[model samples]
Target: MTKKRKSRGRSKGGKGRSDYVECSNCGSRVPRDKAKKVTQRVSLVEPTLARELSQKGAYIPVSYVTKYYCISCAVHYGVVKVRAREDRRTSYNS
Candidate 1:
């Protein structure tokens, strides 16, 4: 069979199996390695209030919200971009 991606679209190299995560947008079950994970820092205080608190030397707390998206949802949400045939084999971070 012909292959489209070297990793078969998953990052679980040499691992037998990976856990599944639900897509935040679609609620679909997808492999943890295959899903697109997005982490966002959320401020507990409003931006204006946070700024004011910061000026007063008050400590403002922030939380990290992690979201997972399936391939379809990721593409729909613009989390991942479709690449050309040649570009598909190249790593974006390289």
Candidate 2:
């Protein structure tokens, strides 16, 4: 049978198994490198309030939230899109 998808790369010097991470949306286990990682800033204060505070020279606390999604969830959430045969080989930068 012919290959369905293009190979990412050769694992020439890799170890046996890889580390896994839990998908934030579906709670499924996915390989760390294969998972889609997303980082978002969560603000403790409301956006309007935070803007007012900032204008007043007040500090607003924000937290960086990181989430990982499996391939299924990533596609479902529009994080990635199905590409054409020619576009499939292109790599994307976050």
Candidate 3:
């Protein structure tokens, strides 16, 4: 597993994850319905960089990847939009 980074309570540094916190970017609170955990790894290929894959019928995965809040529980949580990097693959992640 990748080593955990420290949370500045905003930009960085939080172990594994905690109950909840406010989204620094949006100042929105989120619920941390915790106890269970999820993990994933993704590659970033920016719009211009992802174009090549689109030409080949391949697509990059899109996600929020930003520190955010639950907007419900007044806690901190990670938010992702889960989209396709390309138009053709918009229906799925490649």
Candidate 4:
């Protein structure tokens, strides 16, 4: 059988494998490079209360929450959107 050409921009030389991370929504293992990462800031105090406290010279601490999603989960959750035909990259030569 003949070898199939790589459709993506990746070259077909190396091991082609990568580290994996668990998807936050589906719990599926996805390659680290392929997973979508989202980081959100979490505040210990409510915004209104924090504003009042800050006006009174109080400080509020914030933490960052990071989540990873697989391609399917990301698409389903709106993290990734389907692009129109014209908007898609035209790397493949027909």
What's the TM-score of every candidate structure? 0.88, 0.82, 0.27, 0.73
Top candidate, metric lDDT: 1
Ranking the candidates on lDDT from highest down gives: 1, 2, 4, 3
Whose TM-score is higher: candidate 1's or candidate 3's?
Answer: 1
Poorest stretch of ten by lDDT in candidate 4: 3-12
TM-score of 3: 0.27
Q: Quick one: best TM-score, which candidate?
A: 1
Give residue 7's error in model 3 in angstroms.
33
In model 1, the runs with Cα more than 4 Å from the true position are none
**Is 2 or 3 the stronger prediction by lDDT?**
2
In candidate 1, which residue pairs get closer than 3 Å at backbone N, Cα or C atoms, i.e. clash? none
Report the lDDT tens digits of candidate 1 across residue range 1-94.
7878777898888999998999999899999999999999999999999999999999998999999999998898888899999888765556
Off by over 4 Å in 3: 1-20, 25-43, 66-94
Q: What range of 10 consecutive residues in model 3 has the weakest lDDT sum?
A: 3-12
Tens-digit lDDT string for candidate 3 (1-94): 4323122123323445545645444655443432112333445887677888888989588654434344332223433333333442322122
Candidate 3 global Cα RMSD:
15.2
Model 4 / residue 41 / CA error / Å: 0.5
> lDDT of model 1 at residue 76?
89
